[model samples]
Target: MNKLKVAVIGCGAISRLRHIPEYAANPNVEIVAFCDPNIERAKQYAETYKGRAYSDYETMLKQEHPDAVSVCTPNSLHARTAIAVAEAGAHVLVEKPIASTEAEALAMIDAARAKGVYLMVAQNQRMMPEHVRAKELVDSGRLGKVLTFRTSFGYSGPENWSVEGNGTWFYSKDKAIMGVTADLGVHKADLIRWLLNDEVSEVASFVGTIHKGGTDLDDNAICILRMKGGAMGSLAASWTYYGEADNSTVLYCENGVMKVGTHPEDQIILEMRDGTVERYRADDIATNAGQQSSGIIDAFIDSILTQTPPPIPGEEGLRSLKVVLAAFESQTSGKIVRMT
Candidate 1:
């Protein structure tokens, strides 16, 4: 394809604010079609971005034959939509928490692999500079064997941030499946795994709907995680952070603690065993309100253009979702859940 044609499935918040804008900004991408259950929303995106609107994704895929597709649907629909996109001979970029269940995620991964198509998960935090630096520090051995870690991601609940204000699809048990844990928690889970270069072995968690009083979904989640590398850590994802968002991670190693976006001023701070400290500043994370170049659009387009493997592939996303799923199991069974 000269300039890769792109189709977006689901014209929701993520689709409108991130995927659409980013793809529209990329010179190498031409958005040809938009599909959403809400036809009016799809029509709006189509009118603004120069695309045809369809209520059904299959029809859009068949009609547009886009070179790439962004699956920005709800938590429950990711696997089916992405798999279909890949089967239709298009590279797919699915939003995070790849699917509601491990089996579904695995199936999606298998389908893309079988079709010999690139299937990437939009785990955008991996593109954040602070996270990039922290992962570098751990890999550099400056931390002297990470002994323990703690990470948190929080914001005012999706009720305020979703496209539907208070009555968003995010709170629907039928769509979101799991609450804050699956929403925000999965992002941190993916980040910690990348930063530590290890997978989770076991998870014991306390998840609840503490602050969002009216919702049946959980507003907060705390997971005690044991990494495969024999290090332990705590992961918390919350929607109860009433103030500004707190997205931070701290790693305590034999040397000292390393903070990533966790400090008051510094974006990256490391204190050594000998008492010396190093600090590094990184760019602010991109959000829907103040959207900027996150490198996701570029990366996805590059992978398709170059026929290279995706940076955050389906398996990588599945690994992160597995931890979140394990936490849910732990919350329900009142026991530590061991990951496969």
Candidate 2:
């Protein structure tokens, strides 16, 4: 396979944890450059990846001419950075929530289409083993027509998780855009849309900054979703969970109820109408289909080589971003926001 040279456009935590390691593991991709406004951070990442470092993304794109680039910057910067890199003649893989607003997301999509380059949003939860299995169970008619879903994602603030503490862009409203909803809620919303193969039709939400000493952004949020299939769902995201990572989803269907969590070994517990219970463990039973850790990077490389569409196309990302924006609008207006 001919390897595709790529540049990483942010030296943040997501880039450090997922993007860099995934790229490093993929043999069909080479990390050619690292870019960030913080020269020190770029230099550090470049040293680790053994690639050129640049504080300016435009200069790096001009010089490297990479096949693709990952936009892992602040939420507010996602759309602009993606457009810049995609217009520079490179495919783009942007991190989640897509953009700070609906207009920006649409602009990014248009830029990618105009440039004739593939643009994928890195909604990596779609690639999770448990998530894929959940989709299969729902699609195979085993769920017997889904009824509703309740999902949540929460953790203590990013102070500990981030290299520079939570004082970074994640807590800043100007930089992060919104807080818990944009940071964590987008993942759950994307999963809901993907697993159910439906778009949200309306939303009523409430967002708050309940915690002190944090940035001026929502620390917690709750939203009610009215899906296209006439299913009603609720989702919550918080940075004040106080203990352990809480990433879980529960789906209630006509035939049974299914629960998925990041813990307990990525298992799916099913409780049927007959009072019989079954647990599906991808780790133990199924050879871990889609278990590849670097699936996104590999898929990006293949898209470049084959001229195929990306796994999570830019348009899909905009749809998810619309959910986020609608929720925010609902929170401010105290009304149901139509998501047509």
| C-alpha lDDT (0 to 100) for residue 19 of candidate 1 | 93
Poorest stretch of ten by lDDT in candidate 1:
284-293
TM-score per model over all chains: 0.96, 0.94
Which candidate wins on TM-score? Answer: 1
Cα deviation of 280, candidate 1, in Å = 0.7
lDDT of 1 by residue, 228-257 (tens): 999999999999888888888888999888
Alpha-carbon runs more than 4 Å astray in model 2: 283-294
lDDT: worst 10-residue window of model 2: 283-292
- Pairs that collide, model 2: 159-166
